[model samples]
Target: MLLSSFVRKGLLFFLLTCLSIHISKAQFLLNDSISYQPKKLTTLGISAGAVYGVSMFALNEAWYKENKREEFHFFNDAAEWKQVDKAGHFYTAFYLSALSAQSINQCGVKAKKSALLGSLAGFVLISSIEIFDGYSEAYGASVSDLIANAGGSVFYWWQQNHWQELRLQPKFSFHRTPFAPLRPAVLGENIPTEILKDYNGQTYWLSADMDKFMRFPKWLNLAVGYGAHSMLYARDATNTANGYDPYRQYYLSVDFDLTAIETDSKFVRGLIKALSVIKLPAPALEMSKKGVKFHPLYF
Candidate 1:
């Protein structure tokens, strides 16, 4: 499992590296960085990276740990294996690349053009990456991923259309546990805050297409509904716990799996779900020995 995971992660990293090169081609070079804003696409790109990063760490805390795991398992492994790793990867890459492109275009650098232009740019960029990946040995072309890529775009677009509380679930839960309440960790938005951001204030997570995209039919998929949220940290800055900040940098990650299938597969799905169930649990994950700190593939 370690070897396979390494192979997979290596391939993902390589593709992302190549993707950065592709982005450079699009903008010629990055113009400037932007702050994390709602759906500025650009911030969303980081959100996506944060999602990938946190999920990977939470799922498999010590990837290349002590010896080598016979398997690198996590409930939220990704839509890849279920759909065929190749195409699954392609779709994910395409969506994320599109995400980057959208962010680039979303940057104020563009003119009176609509936000959709940025999305289009993102879509095209992701497409190009797919072509590049198709040429590799470790990876190959995938029609399913292409469809999913297009689907994510279309879904987001559709959200712009009606946005009825009727068409979709008013609000969906992004993260849940057998431990506590079932809901997105809110401090301000839909739900009111009873106790400031610290203990009482509650907020609702925005449900979007990306939320559904991440989940499977069998497992529950959580989403970092917040466009950008600081990972949980301790307010005490002066006396760092034992010289090391106990504050774990916990980035939000979406969960992807299927409730439907899990209901049917019972045994198999239960096992996978159990693995994904515990991770970065409000602890200083960033500082945790299990934390994974890696820059995203930013073009």
Candidate 2:
């Protein structure tokens, strides 16, 4: 089994907090002449090492202790959730790496160096999780997941290198679904838990800035999104027995770039930067196995 949703969120929050603090300190303490000082870099390295060690220990206790196996191996999960999980892996890796690179740049690191370090940090973090999975009996390392992870990191790096800005952003949105109550054990028991576990409610999106391609409003973008529904099991037999038909969802929508809004306040800029990962509420045209549907004010 994977780490509990709470634990995973906590881990990510902790890392982001640490990185933010470090960046703030670097801005306050370092002068242009002494930026990238050896002492600061050493401290950063030690702090990151400590954080990674603690995270690994906590994850092992929470997720791997009961599921570990004698032999390390791989498991094929390419078909699970109609590849929704794979898209998730790619999305997570891309955003984390991009954010890390931005944070590093804020700390007075050169853009190229920051990008390299950030990409490596993202790849290592997710790859470590895959290594843990390799030893688990219930779930093993997945090649497809690794590929997705790399793809995300590479995409982030390539975009930064070429454009110095992300014209195409990966985003996420979620809405509560009635289906979660039908299989609470496999999905989740509450909104918070279900948001993390239920693939049916979550949508992954690639929002492309129209201004990048042609004349258009700077804040507006065209988004293509993917989601899944009725996926209580990886295989169809169990779902059929339970009177559910699993299906994939595709969507087209409009999104906004909060960062594009003029903001002189540092805090507001930071908030906008963080919120950019989320797809804002808008009307969406959805296509699924059953047919077509429209969502007004979709999250």
What is the lDDT for 201 in model 1?
Answer: 16
How many clashing pairs in candidate 2?
A: 0
Q: Report the Cα lDDT for residue 293, model 2.
A: 92
Q: Which lDDT value does model 1 have at 148? A: 52
Instruction: Please provide, for model 1 over 1-299, each residue's C-alpha lDDT reduced to its tens digit, 9 standing for 90 to 100.
Output: 21333334344544344334323221112222444344555554575556445544443344322333232222322332222232233333333443344345444443213224434543453444344234434344445555655654444334433341111211212232121122234221232221222111111222223433454433333333211122222223422432523222223343333322423444555453232222212211112345554323100
User: Ten-residue segment with the worst summed lDDT in candidate 2?
Assistant: 24-33
TM-score of model 1 vs. true structure: 0.28
TM-score against truth, every candidate: 0.28, 0.89
Q: Give lDDT per model, in order.
A: 0.33, 0.75
Q: Model 2, range 13-40, lDDT digits (tens) per residue?
A: 5665665554422111112333665665
Relative to the true structure, candidate 2 has a C-alpha RMSD (angstroms) of 3.5
lDDT assessment of candidate 2 = 0.75
